[model samples]
Target: MPFIPTLTLKDRLPRPFKIRWLRELMDLVDELYFEYGIVHQDIAGRNLFISDTTGSILLCDFAFSAQIGTVRHGQSVYLGEIPRCNDVKGTMFFLYYLITRDPQYSRYLLSDVDENTIMDRPKWVKHAGVELDYDVDTFYNELMAWVRKRRDSPKLAHYTLAPRHFEIPDPPEDGMEGWYLGRSHTMREMEAGRTTLSWERPPASKWDKSRKLLATGKYADERPPVRLMHVPDPKKGFPQMGMTNAALRGQDKRKQTQDVVGTEDEAEASKRRREEADE
Candidate 1:
């Protein structure tokens, strides 16, 4: 096996966060579901690694990965066939946590909290003084927008299970809404003025094979051979790193909350404590 040394997105933070990178990561998720019929089942910053050399993101830790149209324990299972999942899998607040780095929000999402409770922004968000509602709304809007773009893309015509095309499941008679489920109107509205980010495919190189050999102790020398390979320029097809117009508008709308909401520092500190405890 090749020695793939990488750093999780969490470790690379404190630097500027790029919306395009997030879009690319979401694209990977869409590809896994639509093209490969695989559901990662775990989408978190810790599970996503960034290649140090290539600067491209990689999804890892597939212990919980599942496939559509598969039989498991004498039961048929199909995930992402429609909006809303029967099983609650994957890091529920991954995108929200990634953006806000707020432990409170993460904790709330991971718990068996009611959807209505979450939607009641004033009870929690206002009390915490965080613009979580705006953050979550923006994240979902962007995600749905990306899904719509990919579903309509001519290049992805081979994919039969596009998310945008997923049949919206019948609403629960119990009046409980599954926010995870996709809606056609939501997808369409998100795609109205959105543009998909471009990505360049990396060229094939011998660096991986060389790394494997070195890892297996095939070389007698203490020092491994230095190899130079072309690393794809990430900026070539990626959007510029900065906030977009929509984000700016959101910021403007939440200006009041921004002044009063200072939970970001607490969130960062909480995250650090958790990391330390784990260590």
Candidate 2:
């Protein structure tokens, strides 16, 4: 088998470059969960790879990967159904350990860390004699949001709207019976049978170009005038010294006549030279 080229995210310092890499890594994870219903289950620095040519992030080490709502051995798994696993099977805490190198923070991953415990408290880690500040609460919130979304749980919220001080919203009493599945739900579905709430108007229909133009305030109902300056016409032949089309046509005819006369003169001179040689 041919070897595939990949670069691991290990050994890279937590600078701006690595920070951007992590952001892209998270984007890849989001895409996988939302589009493919596949969870990496082992998202860490070493398991991720950056393609040398495309610069796209890749997730490897699928030993712990789980597929939701997929088929196995001719059995179809329904949507929102998850396989049971006794132990936790992800390397998310390894990401924090890589940044802080603190065992305390690593152990905190075993239990839920609330925002009250970390809002005013900032964890400090020393790297190369430089002290870096880590916001433990923000990290925990983001991690929880990511996990819940990957699992297709109804409790997942927008990243910006992730609960900071309070626990995430719980699934309905019916166990997601009427709850919309997947990463997101349409506004119509979210606001079903809600008469008190005011709904914002949806955008113009895609097929309605006039409405789109009106909405954007860039209506161009009339065609713009064409500007005629320094434009060449190949069918009229080359323009001679800024001459117009009529003048260019006259010049071309004259040039062609001159060339025909010159060819006849050359042929007559050759006949005279041959006669003289015969004499």
Error of 1 at 202 (Å): 52
Q: In model 2, which regions exceed 4 Å deviation?
A: 1-7, 11-16, 69-94, 103-121, 124-126, 129-279
- Each prediction's total of clashing residue pairs, residues at least 3 apart in sequence or on different chains, is 2, 0
Expressed as tens digits, the lDDT of each residue in 21-110 for candidate 1 is 566787677677666656665566766766767767677876455555443322345333322331122323555456555566544422
Compute the lDDT for candidate 1: 0.49
TM match of model 1 to true structure: 0.39
Best by TM-score: 1
lDDT of 2 by residue, 161-211 (tens): 333322234333434444433332346555675445333434455335544
Give all TM-scores, in the order shown: 0.39, 0.35
Lowest-lDDT window of 10 residues in candidate 1?
82-91
Please state the error at residue 180 of candidate 1 in Å: 32
RMSD (CA, angstroms), candidate 1: 31.0
